[model samples]
Target: MSGSLELGHHSSLHQAQDSSKCLDEDGRTKRTGTVWTASAHIITAVIGSGVLSLAWAIAQLGWVAGPIVMLLFAVITYYTSTLLADCYRYGDPITGRRNYDYMATVQSYLAGGIKFKFCGFIQYANLFGVAIGYTIASSISMMAIQKANCYHKQGHNSPCHISGNFYTITYGVMQIFLSQIPDFDEIWWLSIVAAIMSFTYSGIGLGLGIAAVVGKCLQLHTCIANPFLVFTDHFASETENKGLKGSLTGISIGHVTQSQKIWQTLQALGNIAFAYSFAMILIEIQDTIKAPPPSEAEVMKKASLLSTLVTTVFYMFCGCMGYGAFGDDAPGNLLTGFGFYEPYWLLDIANAAIVVHLVGAYQVFCQPLFSFIEKCSAKACPASPFITSEIAIPLGSNRCYKLNLFRLVWRSVFVVTTTVISMLLPFFNDVVGLLGAIAFWPLTVYFPVEMYIEQNRIPTWSIKWLCLQTLSVTCCVVSLSAAVGSIAGIINDLKAYEPFKSSY
Candidate 1:
């Protein structure tokens, strides 16, 4: 009787400790994330290869529409994001059952039958598309380094065509190893580093753009040598047709056909959309935060505001400067598109930073998919060791790394599939635009508006409801326009382009 009593005492004590340390208020694994780490993840996801295309986007829209469209997207994104953040829990912001991912939040408050399946398909499909886009983008940056070096030696006019195939495979190899990382929370350090890398390249692009404008002014012997004056004078001259600089109306009808100009302008909207997109992954990042006295929803709103502010500021600087430097002729990628060739070494550094940032951003966007696949597999076969087992590899000093076989094999296959698909398409700007157009309205605007209305029991046709619905409709039309323009661009490019055979 005494021995039995002692065993019961020990078991109760163990349970108490486990309950306190291992589980959060929601009875899930305790999350150690904070505002800073969450912000890092947001920055890593938001500022991607999309920023490199912003200059081209501006060049297509001219000085007026480019910055306006970008700012408009920023406001829309931040507003919708706060709505999504509030949906993190079903009934209440804090006490209710947490919707662990975006699809769960949708199913909780909205129709689940078709809507659930559709949400899952769209969310995961968008993530898959991002992986392909990053693959294409990183390879482009890699190729740019080699091409930059070649330009330094050979003349800029010389044919320095280099195949992106090798560089694409190289990136795939790196991702294969990084893919083995088990979960989103474990990759916090990588996200922080990637966030720093993002700032590095963006700042460099802005600096080079300013330098280019100065260099052009000196070459032209303009009356005003100041960079600011040069920009104003250049824009005025271009608008008046005195110089080949950009105009108030964007790429002229002479440079591109009337139809082509229209398509390019619409496509530029999609590029800006892509640059601002992160809503698809926002909830996933929110899942990493620990319980708050202030609640996860409150914390996420702050993070969203901070992230949007930082990204919008950087986007304006880089995009405006790039357009100011090259005018209507701004390249698709500011750095990799050879906007500044003479600063070969600096260009090389910026491109390298881009590759490094994309490597981490790809994992940031894909980890939720990995987790979803693993959860489904485990649910289907809970008893199988392959699905449930974790082999702890000893690292000496009483430490071991837990390795899961399924995570290894599945993530490897996922990376390889995306790599092959990237090689086939390899149309960077068109692909980015399509991915943005496909994901923006549904993931960023539509679902959030619907979910917020349903969650809060807002009466239909009321002022708030009508306003929200109007916003959703406007975004949907924009998405459709962008999709059409991107598709048209792809068709035009395909007239001479071949899969896996073209060189940059």
Candidate 2:
């Protein structure tokens, strides 16, 4: 994403003009990643804590509408990813070219002074938001694991609780050490491990959901009509009043008024859309592929297709099973919501996977931001050893000392800042909706389609072009509406929580 800024610091205008010469001297060479490794990076980018809430999202839409929305988002995102892959070229289109990062792609094809600047701003801003989201979500998962373990081993009233912020701050400090790795391409092995963790937790969630449904079915002696029916049969007469404690009881589509139904539907749309947001970092991942030119594009496309296939299957299975098991009462996070009893060990394993996966996933998303800051700093301090490595000076020079000091202080500051904000407002689902709404059109849908149409000089009024444009505009409007609604919901939730001084 910071490819354009990389020029500002790493290469001068003279060097930029001679890039073609350098490419000729270097020639085509195998890069770092293979199809499997690249696919792992895509999986790490696509799957996150968002998967945990997809059941609640589907419950809002009910049985018929849920899968449709999830699949639709998957298809839209996959196509946009391919469009991004096509724009990865760094030089001339035909003969001798290299791949460009996200921001550079925008600068190359969509360049108009203000337009390019705005694109860069939103791209990086969305990335920063993602970093915060990962930190916050990971901490919540860790905290939940600790709480559940305590309840399982000791009594419910035992003093085994730890603060969520403590775990978040600790994770942030760990990131400070991990971020010292310096580049994205160097972390393929880490991404692979993270991908495995994602699959493990997702599978565990699916198993728990299935088991819940089977257990319910055995008691009823008949299959439940839907998730709504499951809730009605089990909990309808159990609670005296449907209030805060009873919030988990399933809400039936048949019971809600038209206005309430529409509101919930839109909220579900926002959540599913948020779950599939990985297009922003497509180019950066593409840069890791080993093949050259045309082959690079093909390799990236295959990786994307494979990752989408895997995630879609997992998503459908988990979302459907979760809704079936818990209906409207499903917890925001399936693992955290599990009661600390029969399957306590499984819950612990799942939460541990989540925490570990986020550790790696955070780096995948935040490395771009780190690179951007480093480039900006290098541009400001041309003589600094942090960027230049002080090759001209002795290893023990004072400039190198400043460089080490700058690295520690600067990175620690970013980590601490994100950790503090995450501690302040820990509404994971609503925050995700807002981030998705803000970034969905620009990052996932708009930029790629616009860049494709303009770059290829596709006819403006042709049916194909018109259809793409209409889809883009429709999604932009819907996402903006969803974003506003999410903000309103967040405000209401804050007001509701304020009187009690409840802390996460």
Candidate with top lDDT is: 1
lDDT of 1 by residue, 1-108 (tens): 999999999999999998889789877889987878778778767877898888899989998888899999999999999999999988867788888778878998
In model 1, the runs with Cα more than 4 Å from the true position are: 1-24, 28-40, 216-245, 287-295, 383-408
Model 2 Cα displacement at 371 (Å)? 1.3
TM-score of 2: 0.79
Residue-level error in angstroms, candidate 2, position 326: 0.3
Tens digit of lDDT per residue, candidate 2, span 298-412? Answer: 8888999999999898888878777876666666677776422335666789989998898898887788788788778888988976654522324464533123555556777
Global lDDT of each model?
Answer: 0.86, 0.73
Q: Which portions of model 2 miss their true places by more than 4 Å?
A: 1-28, 32-37, 90-96, 153-162, 185-189, 216-250, 253-264, 290-294, 339-341, 384-403, 498-504
TM-score of each: 0.86, 0.79
